[model samples]
Target: MKVKRYVVDDLPQAVQMIRSELGSDAVILNTKEIRTGGFLGMFRKKRVEVIAAIDEASRKPAPRPAAPTKPIVRKSEPSEESAIPAVQLPNAAVRERYARSTGTSDAPAVRTSAVPSAASAVAVAVPAESPSKEAPERGAFAVPDDPRPARPVQAGAGLAENPDTASLLTELRSMKEMMVKLSKQQTFRSMPDSVMNWSRRLAEQGVEAPIIERFAEEVNDRLGTEGADDESAALSVAREVLLEWLLPSAGSGINSSTRIVHFVGPTGVGKTTTIAKIAADQSLTHHRTVGLITSDTYRIAAVDQLRTYADILNLPLEVVFSPSEAQRAFKKFEDRDLVLMDTAGRNYRNELLVSEVNSMLSPGEHAETILVLSMTQKYGDMKSVASQFAKYGVTRLLLTKVDETDSYGSILNLALEYSFAISYITCGQTVPDDIRPFDPNEWVSRLLGEPAYA
Candidate 1:
């Protein structure tokens, strides 16, 4: 075997060099990212190191044979015909035949056959040309071209007839797939230490892998390997990338024109508390006439909790037991500037429950639904709730319990994946105090564990 090593910018470059130096039959043994030419690890250049090898026997050309003596012709018996020796066809002819037989233009063509028959083995090899006028001798065998279109061959259909070729192709395919997986897995490892740490932090924060990869790519492009060593620089670049991802969904709080806002989510996500905060802000700070409605009779305390806030804020409160009653409650608050309707929190992971709660929501241009999710919840659970609500066109999001979890990637995950407009986020249970409109800058800063950027 002939082995060679190459250091290149990427896998494609290494592949091109290997093919040129070691021929097309060469296989890659291993590949990894390596850093070089740095003084005290300050300004190293990152490159891919690839090891490739090719069989020496395959690389060396076959030697020419000495001239052969003439063969003595033996007379055939009366009932026996003369048998012709098998002809060795060129590689191009064998490939053409294999392609036609398999109906695949790129099928691997091999020299030897696993099963050979007398007729096929004795067939005379010919050059690519039109059929000759003269007929063949009585005992000679010839291959005729078929005019019919080739049929599609099933996978591994011809493998049993050519085990060596099939094995080679399968091994090559496996190697290619392995290389692709390794490339993806090592993508973040190629980044500088500071940048790689942030990638890990984002993953630990529950961010999706694709989003983290894109963020890392953007940061690496901006800072490069040398500058990425500076943690501050990496954080600054990461902040900008995250902000760009989140800015589209920022400042998407409840519109002033919306008169009825329905707060919906799973249990223990602080739906009632979030309603109170928004209602208080609207009534006291914006001076809008706010009315409260609740369909939370499932838990008597749920209704009483909102009633307590309504009494303290001097806002009109209405309670409904069903969708029909909800209509009547809306009529009573028809004159109010803004009505905040709170729905009973159920296991929204169940589509039936989502539909039941969805039935009570006011559907019109004047109403909006806010899916309240707790940041402390698992990302999978949050995604499930969001997906169920999304079926009913609930695009607005209000994340609660932000102070309870250190990981905020779920916020960005929800925003980017579902395109949910994050309207508000609550850090504490304090009504109208801990809750505020979603701030992209502050949230991105927190996600990266950095101070809020200017």
Candidate 2:
């Protein structure tokens, strides 16, 4: 199989390029929207990244056969009687013994044509001089040698005693062992000690297997075997590759034109706390007028919690129970510079609930939806929640509970797998102090075991 990756402006362009380069037989393995060529996560151009592959064996034509050659003929010699002789049992006991020895039925029948002449049958049965003691006794009957060629035994034919079958079984076992070794060599096992150590570190940090292999390959490709064996050189190249992958997904916090921001995620992910942090940042740090809206009527404490933050910040708070009431809240917050809306957290793994929450938000270029995820959650569960939100066009992410987890690879995993722009990350429960815009450099440094600012 031949595999290639293409980054293009759109899916149609990627399809056209794939067809032209890899032929029509090629298929797309995966595709996601990616941002590139931005300074400090500003003015980045959005592009579609596609992974395509084709089987080389399927594309090649089969070899044609050679033309037939004329046959060579020679004169025939006078035939002696055939080496095969007819079997003639003298009595019922002899016939039964012959049948038991040869694993055949004791049916009494004889073919005269098998014996070309009586002399030929006598010569074959008598065996030139005398029978050896090791040879079994033939009681007045001759066992004919079969002239047909032996059939080849296929693999897995269950012939335990056949030498050819045993040899084939040995070869199959050797092939399986060789294939397993080759597969191990393709992964981190074949890398130099230093490079392999780095790969193990990445895996221990929760990095996906494919991403780790790609990182090891990049290290080996950029630096040769000697350089890869050097710990410092391998670490340096791995850091560069990770930074290149992460920087593109770093977001610039909140856009100026985004008037309303909807914060949505699964239950217990700190959605309300994250909203309070963002609201405080916008109002105090940026000196912008900020308002708060909560649609979390499902839980009484949720509404009370946001209201407390509103009281502390001296900001107006609006509580809405339904989509119609949400529109009224938006109308009231139209005069404000920015409005951060807090949604009720639910089991967002259910698509129905996600769509229910999405219906309450205003959709337009001025509105943005942020899916807040907890870093301590399992990557599979987080992926499920993000996938549900992605159906509703939620592309920006705000990760919470960073200090609760030791591994940070899920941040990169979400960015690369779902193509989500990580807007902010909260490290603690502190409202404004713990939250900050995602910095790709700090994150990559921390991921690579470098000391970073807390």
Candidate 3:
């Protein structure tokens, strides 16, 4: 492979130089902005410097063969008028065909009348042409006047003088552009294969590309500085970066000062189920005075689901419709140590619905709003859902369905995007048993492709 660099005024000039020197089979390695002809770097002109390389063995075209010589003819007798009989030369079409088939130019054509059977000689000379007969002249088989209109040739067609050359150039230019784009994207999207293996692992776990890119870069940068060449060392750095970004913490356990905790988010995110789990944990496990208040009147069985859990726990359940009713319920549960309120699940896309729920939960300083999200939902959709519910002054995040997915990147993504702390993660449908408080080290270890340290 031959490598060369061209610093030109613009990309087009660099491309032309590469094409002229390297032909269309060159691969672009790298490109960068360069400044030249400057006085103390004040008056420099900007230019693009391209680094291109081509394999000599592959790019070089094969050499052409020497043309065949004409045979010498001798006069048979004085009666023979001419040494060679009057015969027509083969047309341009036949010459081109012979050249293509033999992969060589300058092959001499024999006179038509010199051989008694001209067609038979042609069949013997070029056996490949036997399957398809030669095409007739354009006007030979045409009816009286041609009806098809002539195509107008283009004017001042730059870099398109020859159709074949233009096609090659266009294809080369397209390839160069794609390579350049991919090269640029690699700065943000790609990493060395050693580190990239972890990036793919993260992606397979359902982590978003941008987050994986960041982790890979951090790992690579750390490895570069420390001169740690081992793959395990790079993975350690990745794990550290993810742990720092995750910011996981155990949920602020129910305390005396904490009076009301309201759960709010989009539809079917297990808001009621989550509340039931927490209620069970507080009432049965923690042995605290726990009560339930719900405004989830949308679903057909939301109220009944909560009622069943409330009956099992043997705690007072308050069903409210409006903010006033919620306030009244808060007053009813004032004596309790902890009150878990479940709000109606509505599409957070509607501003009015979020605002209404926000108002319902915005009762007093003791009230803490926690936005519940499902792990099964995409990070992008989670971002949208979080943005809408952010107006609720979300204090913490409660992620549901952790057992349903392999990836935990969405947890870190939402934490960074919304700046909301994760309090708990519910993994299964079993009340109290499925829920676990967020543990920083354990979550990070699991996310970075290690078994949970917990």
* CA-lDDT, candidates in order: 0.80, 0.80, 0.74
- Count the clashes in each prediction: 0, 0, 0
lDDT of 3 by residue, 1-454 (tens): 8999999888888888999989999888999998889888699999889999999999667975432233323333334233332222345554565567566675444222212231332211222212122332221111111122344546846357768888998899999999987885776454566677777777876677777767777888887844445787877777778777776434665555878998999998999999989988888887789989999898898899999999998989999999898889888887899999999888887888888888888467777888899998988788888888776567588999988887787877776667787888889999889998887777777766675432
- Please identify which of the two predictions, 2 or 3, would achieve the higher TM-score against the true structure: 2
Against the true structure, candidate 3 reaches a TM-score of: 0.58
Clashing pairs in 2: none
Better of 1 and 3 by TM-score: 1
By how many angstroms RMSD does model 3 differ from the true structure?
24.6
Q: Write the per-residue lDDT of candidate 2 for residues 243-336, one digit (tens) a residue.
A: 9999889998998878999999988999998888888889999889998999998876998999999999999999998999999999998899
Error of model 1, residue 298, in angstroms: 2.2
Worst 10 residues of 2 by lDDT: 67-76
**Candidate 1's residue-wise lDDT over 1-454, tens digit each?**
9889999999999999999889999999999999989999889999999999999899778875532233222234323333334334655665576567557776352323221233343233433431244443342223433223346657877785798988899899999999987997797677788888888889988899999888788889999757978988888888788888999888557788999999998888998988888888999899999999999889769988999999999999999988899999999888999999999989999999999998898888999988889988999999988998898888889888988878888988998999988888898988789988888989887887774431
Candidate 1 regions exceeding 4 Å error are 1-137, 140-176, 451-454
Q: Candidate 2: list runs displaced more than 4 Å.
A: 1-187
Estimate the TM-score of every prediction. Answer: 0.64, 0.61, 0.58
RMSD of each: 21.2, 20.6, 24.6
Segments of candidate 3 deviating more than 4 angstroms: 1-183, 186-191, 225-228, 248-250, 253-256, 451-454
- Cα error, residue 432 of model 3, in Å, equals 1.8
